[model samples]
Target: MNSERILILIKPDGVNLGHIGEVITRIELKGYEIESLKVTHATKDQLHKHYANLVDKPFYPDIESYMTEGPIVAIIATGTKIVNVFHRMAGDTDPSKAAFGTIRGDLGREWSDGLLRNVVHSSDSVESAEKEIKIWFPEK
Candidate 1:
């Protein structure tokens, strides 16, 4: 089978709001296979390294704190063009601007909290998918 794998993270807000199943269902319904899954709390070091490119950004601290707030669901989904497909399913990073029917569009909203709380994160490209999958599921 010719398939590509992408990493999907159901962030703290999504986990706390209990939207994990819904998110998984959406992915499955889209014909992607769940290759691996786990629910765990992220550590500061992991997040910092995961988002190393954004480490110097002003919102980096807020993002780190938000990611570590609660348990997150890390998923590895596989299918053709999985990276692009998953990114579209996750919707725009800004919920306010995301098109309706996407995971974020339907379940996410601007939070009073300063950090962006979009419900999910999906690898944006093939290279990113490889890098992120290794980071989240090294055993794979």
Candidate 2:
């Protein structure tokens, strides 16, 4: 049997707001298996590597600042097409614009800090998911 693994980050906002449990619950209820989980502070190198494509962008610093401010829940979820499905469950990047019943719509809120704080981050593709899994869960 083939299984897909995805990297899902419950961002600082999600962590600070105490949505980790709820987020995990949603993932579990959706029938995805969490292979690994942790609450950790991301290092600059890791963040830079993770968002390497955005490193040169003007908004990258804000993301770095926000991501480093607090601990985030790092999750490795596995299932068939887990990457695609979790993206839908995570909703849009803008919480306010996300549809109801999604994790963002139900528990996320907008912050004045621009896009630095949304709610979560999910790998957009299976290929990307593998790369991201190494970033957040290098040992695995």
Candidate 3:
């Protein structure tokens, strides 16, 4: 099998809620090598580019706002089929809907603010992983 790399972001909620260590632990435990990592306060330009597909949508502003609320941990993990594997690890976008053993399912919640607030973000496919990896780790 060909090795793959993925962009994984431990969102503000995940960092703020003290799940960074837990999240990274799970990744390591899964046997993927973390290629690079950083703690960053996202900029609007970055967010705009990252969510360009969603920018024209009505709720784009909400996403931008939520993302800027705190610092996020950006990660690049490498392994065979890491993109798809990490997606499963991240679980559902809605924590309440994720399975019990998944990251979001175990650590995230259906917040009172009614926001998605899922703990992590992972590339959905190899093509997307390439595009997204550039956005978050341009220097790579």
Return the top candidate by TM-score: 3
Candidate 3 local lDDT, 1-140, one digit each (tens): 99999999999999999999999999899899999999999899989988989999998988998899899999999999888889998999889999999999999998787777998999898988889889999998
TM-score of each: 0.96, 0.95, 0.97
lDDT (0 to 1) per candidate: 0.90, 0.90, 0.92
Model 2 global lDDT (CA atoms, 0 to 1): 0.90
Per-residue lDDT of candidate 1, residues 41-70 (tens digit): 888877877898999998898898889889
lDDT of 1 at 62: 89
Off by over 4 Å in 1: none
Clashes of each: 0, 0, 0
Q: If both were scored by lDDT, which would come out higher, candidate 2 or candidate 3?
A: 3
Candidate 3 CA-lDDT value:
0.92
Which order, best to worst by TM-score? 3, 1, 2
Worst 10 residues of 1 by lDDT: 40-49
Model 2 worst lDDT run, 10 consecutive residues: 110-119
* Residue 43 displacement (Å), model 2: 0.6
What TM-score does candidate 1 get on C-alpha atoms? 0.96
